[model samples]
Target: MPRIAYFGPQGTFTEQAARTFGDADLVAVETVPLVLAAVRSGEVDSGCVPIENSVGGAVTATMDALAEDEPLIAVAECVLPVRFSILVRPGTRAEDVKTVASHPHALTQVHDWIAANLPNATPVASTSTSSAAVLVQDGEFDAAVCAPVAVTHYSLETLATDVADVDNAVTRFLLVSRPTRVPEPTGADRTSLAVVIAHAEPGSLASTLSELALRGINLTRIESRPLRGQIGEYRFYLDLDGHIGEERVAGALAALHRNSNQVRFLGSYPKADQSPSVPSAKNTDDDYQAARDWVRRMREGR
Candidate 1:
């Protein structure tokens, strides 16, 4: 059985995503680092880690792991809607609760509700939302800010539903593995690369980016990091449409050499199926639909 790891303490969303993405039999862990460690140590075949959230922005921990962790390649990605709910021990009611605990991100998501409804209750950080749910299940915490799935997983009661600050809260997670499998292309494909440009050349970035635009290639994402050193040299991680095998993506990479001192193609896997990007329209209905559409796309990729 292939084992998959995620930030888990039995009820976390990461664990739910792992199970949702994989068949039964994979194991989950408690921290993001453990996911990498498990894969690197041959304890697991693959792992899932959050990359970004629509509401909260980037997950720096996973980004750093991707930046430095070797012997692992991003093989797949999935987006999970960041829907949260207030959970309590079985038979517990909302008014009776004194305190509520959750991860920092989840705590922030339901901040207003915590202040207004449970004013005197102290906020506690309990590792992850799922961990919070697990903690509540153990009867230690009065309530927990957790996912709907976590409530079910821990047999907890839901006091409030869909407590995210925004209606379209979502998170993207990438499944990574050691020695990524190179599947033969079936039309749609995407590639991820980590590029580091020579710091001495000021013009490197302009050329690095323009080269692709000059080639008429559309970049999906460009993320940068400063190399740990005296002055300032940075590593850029890029995601581009299409496989590296394709002529355009390949040519774009070749053109990148003129400006980039180092380039690493992280992986070129089957591209995730995505719908056409919705345009910004002029009304509340359109806006709502757009949010719903984006949330749908985010969940679809997952």
Candidate 2:
């Protein structure tokens, strides 16, 4: 069985995402950087880490890690609904809680719930939700806001279940590995890229994106991260609605490469929701091929 490293001490949402990779030797690592480093160093075949959450937007650590060092590619992805549980030692009453611990993102999602329910408890941040549960298990904290699976791993009772401040909150996780054979395009796919525009001037970024817009590609997400040590410069991470293998997508990527100062192909894989993109008649694969053929014929004096 292939070994996979995940951002965890186990019982994290990332662990749930890693399990979706089917049967594999799952190794729990401390942080997202460590997970990707394991993949880069050949310590594991792949690494699973949270990329973004519906409530909190992008996970900056994961985004920045992906854009730096030896390139790693996301081979697969999983999206899990964000529902937290407040776990405490058996027999602990809600009023007795003084400190509630969780990951920063988890703390944000459950902030309102915590305030309304455990108003006296101070919220504390931990490296991971499961780690928070570990602290609670060790009697370091009064309660832990963690994934439901955490209760099974730690000796804790659920004080509250199915907790979330917002409805339909979800987190997206990526199964990344060192660049290898790209996954064959599944009609319902997503391609991720990191691009740096050649200039910071207005319209420069828009002009670069026009490459995709002109080809009728749909962008699902775009985020800007400041470039390390390069004052005033930034890197843009983009998630588009098609695979790199598709003609229009390939054309757009080629254009981006030519226009941008740097273009990094993160990966192209099936979207977690498996929803296919709806392309217009003028931008379909056949349309692109026809355009290519017309240019060839003109050059051939046909």
Candidate 3:
């Protein structure tokens, strides 16, 4: 069985995502960076880490880690619905809770729920939701706001279930491995990239984006992170709706390479939702092939 490391203490949402990703020898690690490091060092076959949350937005740690160090690529992804449960020692009542511990993001998601339900309880931040349960298990906290799956790993009872400030929130997780042969392109796919513009002048970023726009490529997401030690400089992380093997995607990437000082191909993998991308008539594969053939004929004096 392939080994997988995840941002976990065994019961966090990332672990749940790892399970969804594949049947692997799942190893629980402390943080996102550690997970990627293990992958870089070949300590595991792959690492699973949360990348984006619908309620809280990008997980910066994962993004920055991916952009830095030896390159790693996401081979698969899993999206889990965000849900929190207040877990406590058996026989503990809601009124008995004085302090509730959870990861910062989890705390933020369940902030309002805790206020209305356990007004007297103070919120403490733990490294992760599963670790919060560990705290509660060790008598450090009165309750833990964690995923329902955490209860299976700890001797805790659920005081409340399905708690969240927003309905239908989901978190996206990536299964990353050291750079290798990319997965075969599925019709429904996503390509991730990290790009640093060649120039900081006006229209530089727009010029880079136009390459994709001209090819009819659809960008699913874009986030800017400050470049390390480069004051005011930023790296743009992108997710576009196609695999790297596609013609338009490859063309856009080639253009991006020419237009940017740095372009890191993160990976091209199947999208978790499996939604197919329908290309416009002008940008279809046949259109590109015909254009290439016509150019060849012109060169041959046809």
Instruction: Identify the runs in model 1 with alpha carbons over 4 angstroms from their true place.
Output: 115-122, 186-188, 257-259, 270-273, 276-302
Write down the lDDT that model 1 would get: 0.73
Alpha carbon lDDT of each predicted model: 0.73, 0.91, 0.90
Clashing residue pairs in candidate 2 (N, C-alpha, C atoms within 3 angstroms): none
Clashes of each: 2, 0, 0
Over 20-122, each residue of candidate 1 has an lDDT whose tens digit, in order, gives 6658555767678888888888887788887777787777777767667675777877777877788887677667788798999889888887888777678
Worst 10 residues of 1 by lDDT: 275-284
Comparison by lDDT, 1 against 2, better one: 2
Ranking the candidates on lDDT from highest down gives: 2, 3, 1
Best by TM-score: 3
Candidate 2, position 285, lDDT: 85
Candidate 3 per-residue lDDT, tens place, 203-227, comes to: 8789878988999899999999879
Candidate 2: misplaced stretches above 4 Å? 91-99, 115-127, 200-202
List ranges where model 3 is wrong by over 4 Å: none
Candidate RMSDs in order: 11.0, 2.1, 1.9
lDDT (0-100) at residue 25 of candidate 1? 56
